[model samples]
Target chain A: MSTAEPPAVAPGATVAELGEEALIALITPMLPHAPGELVGSGDDCAVLALPDGCAALSTDVLVEGRHFRAHWSTGHDVGRRAAAQNLADAAAMGALPTALVVGLVMPPTTTVDWVRDFAAGLAAGCRECGAGVVGGDLSAGESLMVAVTVVGDLQGRAPVLRSGARPGDAVVHVGTLGRSAAGWALLEAGLAPRAETIARAAACLDAFRAPRPPLHAGPALAAAGASSMMDVSDSLLRDAGRIARASSVVLDLGEPEAVLGADVELLEEVAAVLPGTRPRELARWWVLTGGEDHGLLATVPQASLGSLPDGARVIGRVREASAQGPGVLVGGRSAGADLGWDHFG
Target chain B: MSTAEPPAVAPGATVAELGEEALIALITPMLPHAPGELVGSGDDCAVLALPDGCAALSTDVLVEGRHFRAHWSTGHDVGRRAAAQNLADAAAMGALPTALVVGLVMPPTTTVDWVRDFAAGLAAGCRECGAGVVGGDLSAGESLMVAVTVVGDLQGRAPVLRSGARPGDAVVHVGTLGRSAAGWALLEAGLAPRAETIARAAACLDAFRAPRPPLHAGPALAAAGASSMMDVSDSLLRDAGRIARASSVVLDLGEPEAVLGADVELLEEVAAVLPGTRPRELARWWVLTGGEDHGLLATVPQASLGSLPDGARVIGRVREASAQGPGVLVGGRSAGADLGWDHFG
Candidate 1:
């Protein structure tokens, strides 16, 4: 991360004070230029040429307090998270993210510097995944909220759907598991004790704030003959269960110790910083129920498993459903009570 | 309009009581499906086959209190208005509206019936403009907010831009001019008078509640060789000035009698229902500077003026910029105080 401090704002200066047109002008330059787009921002609509002739569309909404607390996250962090969540959806569909249309609903008290930083972070997020922020809308609201819609090109490849898993498929993942949850735990516990532990915790916090999903892994897996795919935004057990149900198969995730060896080590490092927590138990819980990591998860045929791209880890297998119904199982037992994040729960 | 009353919810039922999954299941059926879409809602991303190989995108955010009041407008009205605004942007770009991805943020106390009705209204709006609701995201927030992103197909035609207007072009418009503004005035005045006036007030209120833009006129104008085009979301003088500045020409909208004949009659009808307002003066004010009608405003070459489609009316003329700066002029002078709607100001 850059050590540069955020730009300062005038005391008590707000979005309402700056006015809509002035705020638009201020943030307009922060957007990165998108090549090949017929039109980009500043117009009634943004026009883009899709060479692949197919478009992948996805949208995600992040509300203040619910998604991210202002006290815990910077404006940049919020923007980055919002972009990552939506762009990750596009990547999960085996498409290359091309553009984003952002909608921001901010309170009048929001500072100009905050809005600018938010735009900067959005541009950075798009750059991270090889996309551009092409258009956006801004409005005043009672609380800060962001709605991001992403458009992607499939490049003539068939979209990888979650309902394609079959029996005898090897379930594999291509990004970090439980790191974001561990990071959330660390932040919640308020632990910043030793220097080494602080560095580990900082990494976890960064993962939680701005997820780095393996974007290329999606298309790689799709090309490698993966039977099914989805981004793991919810808990592995819950999200895997969705594939299981969708495909009418059972996903046996095996033991946590065997499946999440490296993740366990990271959780242990985080647990060492806190006093009354068991490292193994915490690791198991985070691996099973942690959400928001935005990792790409897919199922490959056993014969094609050798073609899995670098960083892919085999963790489970797809099997014919039995009497227990199609769902996720860990060590051959049902995962109950920890079914991941539910917005209205 | 359907005379069937909106469904009712139990007095104490809320979104929290129903849960996100249940709410989603209920509202999913309300969306109008796109026939050619490969993947629709319920997937990570909606996949659409675009025969034109190009897409026009636009987004708009509407906050509860800032854009609409729950007390003043029904949930359906809010949804329709949101859809209309985004779709109009697509039309202004001379694109055929294809799909919409909506992002909704509402308080937990919101009822299921309200959400369902909102979805119904969105579907109705899409049907009106020959589009489909392909995907969406819903989240809980402190207040009600809707962010709509629309995708449109250009049909292999060049996008109409605001910068394309030339001097001596005839400015024309299709759809209502100031009825929405007049309706807003009536709603603000809190007037509910006796029989005859009540009927007129109801018409004005309906105009404010649900704006029906001339979606078909967009492509027709483009086909008729319009020089420039835009949707009139802000007041006429203000929005016309945008075209003037963008095209480096001046828009001279002559007397209200010549520019807004039918609109004047409607404004007079609305003003007649009110007790202490002068119809002619109020008509001129609203016609000159009112907003939120979502009408199509375009400039066409003088030779193609005869090709203007039905419902389109000649409003003004584009002229070369002189000593006065390039912008809008009314009655041979700069429109001074009534510049148009400014969200912040």
Candidate 2:
């Protein structure tokens, strides 16, 4: 990812030219430092710490066409997205990410610079989140896909599993919702992508590629005594539904306009993409069903709900679980049937 | 994989009918029980205990058309190969197999039964080495590629790193040297199409498709005070070269015949196809440079070598590194360079 591109790489130094050993040499220094990292990028296995009583783990995969468009997201963006998604899952469990292991597959024709940029994206994501890229494998592939597994340190807190949600908790979201979806729509429409802050839009597009999950948010929520939490990879509603179903509780959303923020450039972009359409429809769709944004979602009991830490906002409430569908309710209405992203639909 | 030949699922129902949720439901129960399994297969990550210490982790990718020819290995065989390779790496580290998480990508045209069989292979490999397929991500792809990360418990044993070999250590092999290489030659040569054990030659074909690493060989070496060990996924001469280079030592094979057993059969089959007298040359090539078959190579001090554990045998010994070159020696003569598999070349 050096924008100071001096013809990509030195002449005659192909990705194949580097091979596996040299490739490891090129990528190892980019990783963050971890305590129990007996083995990092080189060799076969990576050894990581567990401390006295805690271990948090999560993994996510991003296929080229299914989760991203190469034309829309740069290689760095793709790496970030891959790392972010996995990191989000670890955060959902109230874990502080310690190390990241990546498995990358790309066509042999792909440039060496692209792989470097991709690794840099993953490194930047981990660096920003305070985690290390511990180990990874690269193979000649037909299409691009990134698989990342994140191992985290809980610092002795009990993992907050999805099934740990209880009734009458406040449903909250950490980080902005619907921005990635809106950015995706803008890019899909061939519109020039811009945000209220050009940097924010770029960051949001970057978030779409490499999400900076509020890993700090999970520990904060746990410290704040939050009950149940999960990363919102799927839409807010769909992910909330997961907590609801797993916890056997009903999740009720307050209102759409109530959750809308003042900074709304992405919504405007979506509107520009579809002329004569209101931003509400696009935002509603993104909030309710779009998957892969990888923000964090949490639910807390009524008493502890007031203790939500920074970067989190109350978006809904949990109700009693019935025999019917379990999910967020809008205006006393359920988010209704599932429309979340499906792997094979 | 039903041994009784269960009905094959149509390609459309691959991941389509079962979906992600159903596929999880189908395989989660098949995983073996483990005390360290804090999390397994259900949630975003599979959690396991670190044995009051650290965990050894390794990942490898087996891509279709690159790692194994799909026509040779059944879908089940591919799955087994994917899981076993990683497990072997962990074992080579003297770590007890604890868990495995896989990221599998394939085209939508794959069959549900094929996936089910693949899962069976993964579960089987896990069972063979005291591990389980704890968690995995399923996605649609352009080709079938299985990426697996295997986690193991050290049980407090010092991890055997590739850099641990010393000048005075004895090199040893814990499994067969060149069966899989010969298997490939047999399949590539259509000479055995009419043999009585044509299916047997096909079994050799199966060997290349899915190498069953001697799972027990690793920990035993660790327990017997082996100094350094690694899995031979590339070739014997090549993988041994890795340990030598990493430890900055020289390896001398002392004239052990490189061919034995069914490897001779492979030469016979090749002779039938090419009709010349080149068994010695052909056998030499397969034993020296074939890839895939994951065998273990270790270096142990000779005093402790007599206490060699089951399945382990001294094949060579370490010598002082020379500035001229550092590599394997055969028959009191320097061996040819470029003796192992290099993916890029």
Best by DockQ: 1
Q: Where is model 1 more than 4 Å wrong at Cα?
A: A1-12, A192-197, A272-275, B1-12, B192-199, B272-276, B336-338
Q: How does the DockQ of candidate 2 come out?
A: 0.61
For candidate 1, the iRMS in Å is: 0.8
Error of 1 at B167 (Å): 1.2
| TM-score per model over all chains | 0.94, 0.92
The lDDT of each candidate is 0.83, 0.72
Tens-digit lDDT track for model 2 on A1-345? 001112334654666765655555666666575556767755667787678545666666788898887887788888787878887777777877778888887776666777778888887787766788778777777788888887877777777877777777788888767667766765666653444236545644555555667778887897777778877776777777777777778888876557656434455545555556786676667656766667678887777766777778887777787777566677687665466766776
Consecutive 10-residue window with the lowest summed lDDT within model 2 chain A: A1-10
Can you list the residue pairs that collide in candidate 2? A46-B57, A80-A210, A81-A209, A81-A210, A250-A319, B39-B47
The Cα error of candidate 2 at residue B287, in Å, is 1.7
> iRMS of every model, one decimal?
0.8, 1.6
DockQ of each: 0.81, 0.61
lDDT of 1 by residue, A1-345 (tens): 001123334766888887777777777777775545889877899988889789999888999888887876788988888888888888888888889999998878788889888988888888886788778888888889999999988888999888899999999998888888887776667653342247767777877877888888888888888888988887898889878877889988888778778677877778667678888888788888998889988999999888888899999999998887788888988776238887777
